[model samples]
Target: MPRDQILTFFSKYIESELGMIYSESNDFQLQNRLEEIVKLHNFANIGELYQSAQKGITGSLRQLVLDVATNNETSFFRDPKYFRAFENLIEKQIKGDLFSDKELRIWSAASSTGQEALSVAILIKELKQKYASDLSFSILGTDISERALEKAREAKYFQLEVQRGLTTPQMLKYFTKNDKDMWVASSELTKHIQYQKMNLKDAFYPHEGFHFIFCRNVLIYQSVESKIKILSKLESSLVDGGFLILGVGESLIGLKQDYETIMLDNAVVYRKKQKILKVA
Candidate 1:
């Protein structure tokens, strides 16, 4: 059992390190996650781990802590309605000449294990077949967890993982079961995605002009101030009039200065205001 001091200190450290907040209500939860790491490292108690963290210990242990602390919960086509809105946006943009030769960039800002990004790729493949043969998509999947990104790059998943939001048609259409009895995304389906590590709090955002961004389900972990800042950066990175898809429950509320809410069947879609007038 971890002592009270250890839990308190650990929670604060996690908040500082990763910008994830854990309060006294979450002590048991924190203890549960920490205990696994504690046993893995063969530490006698949580105190030793605490000491190591305070000493600025850098290694697998710290990385594991941050990785586990993050909510890596994701699945293909997570919140199906968002994908519907996405499909609608794509159809709209392509008709406006946004699909002409130039790469259609979509950023899955916190793509856990790449399911969401791969889902987008699959949808694009379908769209390309019908609307524009030459339309090319460049999907970028960014996560703070290197471990998650590694799995994403691999694009392999167990039966249960793929079952979350994929239909039989989608499964048979886009993935193949491997020797290990796991389903792997087909090369054709994954051809356009590039996975990389990015921290939302960091000042430097490397790429921009994305036509669509699936920055979903990640902002709930951050404080309001952090959410505002992150949303601002995400907004700035998008091409003018590009769409930003947040998780189903997340909203700009008093926060959407440059975005307007567009309601879908069961989700909120934020579209960035256009920079200048273009004759229709």
Candidate 2:
């Protein structure tokens, strides 16, 4: 097949499967990535790899493509302002007696390698220690890449990863170094988290809505249509009055969703507005 044909095929396949756009403007980047995969697996060449994938990209091959295509660049407590905003939300909710008999549920919708979710776990632990000793909480960390999910489940990070957003005291308190010098998350932190594989392109929502959803740095890769669709689903996945924190540059300015705008702790977040019932 022609090079253009191959690029088009893989581009369409990736967007369909992962909701990530590989537009013509970035064809060179995508081609380079495909070539990297070709070299990594010794696939004769790009054409040969395409031929094999054309037969059917399933199982391990598909996973390898996805793992490479995804940008799993994440670190502990990424964007401190976001965590500060979340802490403010928790305090406000607690003041309103929101957790009287409820479990605080948080969903890290694109929890690459689990740092974001684990950060929330650590923050919540500290909050509980300060005021709400009986506070109950659970965190669901989901990512489309199984490889990333595996790393998240392992709950281990290198020294550099641990240092990215952690204070020395925080690290010493919550992580222990293994023989390999990897900082392993303490049971106290991991116990409240569950890692799962999920593709946001799919229509999925938990039966019990989450109080906070972190879909940060994810929608930027998606097409505008895909972004709107995912945002709509995210809105539905949040409990009324729940919070949604997108990446710092992401916004709902053009979207139809009516999530209330919230600004706190130098971060702008969105809150799912309470639904009103009309009289019959």
Candidate 3:
């Protein structure tokens, strides 16, 4: 098949299957990725690759394409200031009368390999030790990749994954080094988090109403129309007065009208506006 035809075919397939949009300018990169898929699938050429993909031998091949096309580059505490602000927000929520119990529910919307969710759990544990409160919290981490979720379930990290945003003290307190010299998150920390596969484009929301949501960086890949739809759905999933934290570079501007942006000392977080009850 001609390069242009191959690019066009794959581009449309990706957009329809994964909600990914690629342009002709990305032809070289796309071709390289497709060539890798061809090798992996044992296709003789691009013609065979497309035919096999169309015939539904594309499940594994599709995952590879989505994994490569989507940017899943993430780190523990990728944004420090946002986390600091998160801690403060949790404390304030606990102190407020709005919530009768010390129950906090948080969701890491695109938790890739569980670092962000685990980090939040660790912070909660640390806070519990200091305050001596019987606080109940749940951290739910979801990603679209089954492979990534499997890694998250392992709760083990290579040297490189461990080096990011983890301090020596944290390493000592929350992790154990195996004989292989790899750092594994302590079972206690991993116990609080649950990892599941989720597609943000789908209408289904996590069952629980979230007190805090970290949907940072994932929206950049989505189209503006998709962004607005997803953000609106996310707002509905949040509790009244609940906080939504986005990537520093992301914004809700021209997206939704229900959330009010609050600038904290460390980060800017969005909160759903409280609805006032009118007396008859």
Candidate 4:
């Protein structure tokens, strides 16, 4: 078969499984990204890589391909503007009957390696001095990558990963170096997190009715259909008036109308619109 035909057949297969759209406009980008994986796996070229993907690619290698296609740019307190908004939202939420049992629940959907989720915990801890008198919180971080989830469960990161969004004071207070010289979440910070593997395409999540759901930077790889389905599920899974924070570059346009946009100083966030039932 010719090269274009082969590429077409395989791109469709890849996009079907991972929902990463590639076309004439962005084929070069995909090819460039796949080049490194080809070299890493010792494949001669794209042709051999496709053959391996068709039959011989291991589960882990398939995941790597997906990761390469979907850029997972994340870090602790990534974009402080959003963190500031989140803190303010939490403070506002506690002033009313929003939470029961004095417990705050947050879900870091597609949490990757868990930095984002831990950042939320750190913010909560810092703010506890003022309002969290008897309240407690739990953060649930979900991702499709088992390796990422393993690292998240370990609560460890390399120096560069830790430095990306962490300040010197934050580095000192919330993390310590391990025997391998890797920075890790402090003992206190990990207590509130539960890392698990979850695919957003699924109809049900492990937990539901989250007070705050952060599905940041994960939707860029999804198809419009997948986006609509997942966004709808997320909206329904939130407590009435609960928060939904998307990535700064993302918008809920042409997807679903389950959320009302809340413009903030730093970033844009959304609130699940509570349905008011009219008596029949």
Candidate 5:
């Protein structure tokens, strides 16, 4: 097939199937990735691959496209400032007689491979040991990729993945090294976290209310319209005055007015406005 035709097919297919938009300038990358798919599917050429995909000769191939397009390049504690801010938020929320519920529920909305979720779990464990007594906490990690969720559920990581965001003491406290030097998260840290597969663009919300949500860096890939829609849904799922953390580069400044932005030391988090109760 001609390059223009191939580009058109990919543009429409990606946008409709995975909510990804590929521009003309992405020809080289798209061609390279498509070639990999073609080789994997045993297609002779790009044209053949497109034809087979159109005919549904390979159902899983379609899913593969979506996966490749949406796969994120992430690491443990990609942003340290956010974690610091998170620690402060937790401390402030639980210090005085403000809430005093002693129960905190957190959601890592785009927890690619569970590092962020596990990181939060580790921090919470540290906090519980230091200050809060008999605190109840749950951290739910959700991603759109089943494969990623499976990897997260395993609670094992390569040495490289474990190296960042963890000190030697933290590693010794929360992880065990296998024969290959791979790090496996301790059962204690894993106990508080549950992994689930969720598509943020879905019509209905997957999880219930959460005290805090980390959806950083994921929305940048989405269109502005999609971002607003997803943020709106997230707002509904957050408790009033609950916190929403986005990537340092991501913001809701001009996107939505429903959330009030709160600036921490280095992180800017959004909070839904609480409705005041009126006395009769």
Candidate 6:
């Protein structure tokens, strides 16, 4: 088979599996990544790799492709405004007793390397110390990359990773340096956080709905239809009047009408719109 045909086949396959778009503009990127995979796996060429993929590449090869294709660019508290917004919302909820049983549930949908989830945990810890001593919360950190999840579970970061969006006080307070000089997340942050492997394109349901869901920096890679589907699922996974925090530039303007846009601090967030019942 020709090289163009192989690239086209793999591009479509990646979209069908991951819902990640690979247009002509990004063809070079896709081709480069595919070639890297070919070299990594010692395949003769892209065509040979494609042939192997077609012949039941269900295990390692499939996971390798997915891992290579995924963009796991994340940092601790990547968006300060959003974190401040989340903190304010939680504080308000706590004061108003909006929590049903003094317990909060949060989902970091594309958790990446667990920074976002751990950041939420750190905020919750602070809130518990200052306002509600008995407040308890659980954070679910999920991603599509097993490699990323492994690193997240380790909860260790190099100096540069810790320095990105983390202050000196926060780094000293929440992390301890190991012999290898890697900063590890404190127990207080990790105790309530759990990591899992999840694909946003698939249907997902949590055992219980979350008060807030952070599915950031991911929908941009998906098609508009895929984005709508993902947004619908994320909405369903939220409790009534729950919040959905997306990436800084992401908007739901033309996608769905089920959410009410609101601003907390300087960050824009969405709240699940309550349904009005009609009397027959």
By lDDT, who's the top model here?
Answer: 2
Backbone clashes counted, model 5: 0
| Residue 258 local lDDT, model 6 | 88
CA displacement after TM-score superposition, residue 189 of candidate 4 (Å): 1.0
Candidate 5 — which residues are off by over 4 angstroms? 1-3, 56-59, 97-100
Give the Cα error of residue 255 in candidate 6, in Å.
0.5
Residue-level lDDT of model 6, residues 70-95, one tens digit each, is 88999988989999999898887778
lDDT of 3 by residue, 6-102 (tens): 6898888777665666777778888887887778768898888887767763667778776666667788888899999988876765566445546
Which prediction has more favorable TM-score, 4 or 6? 6
What are the lDDT figures for the candidates, one per model? 0.84, 0.89, 0.82, 0.81, 0.80, 0.88
**Model 1: how far residue 188 lies from native, Å:** 0.7
The digit string of per-residue lDDT tens for model 5 on 222-275 reads 778888888998988888788899987889977956888888877888888898
Candidate 3, residue 82: how far the Cα is off, in Å: 0.8
All candidates: TM-score:
0.92, 0.94, 0.91, 0.87, 0.91, 0.93
The lDDT, on a scale of 0 to 1, for candidate 1 is 0.84
Give the candidates in order of lDDT, highest first: 2, 6, 1, 3, 4, 5
Look at candidate 6 and give me any clashing residue pairs: none
Task: Itemize residue pairs with steric clashes in candidate 1.
Answer: none
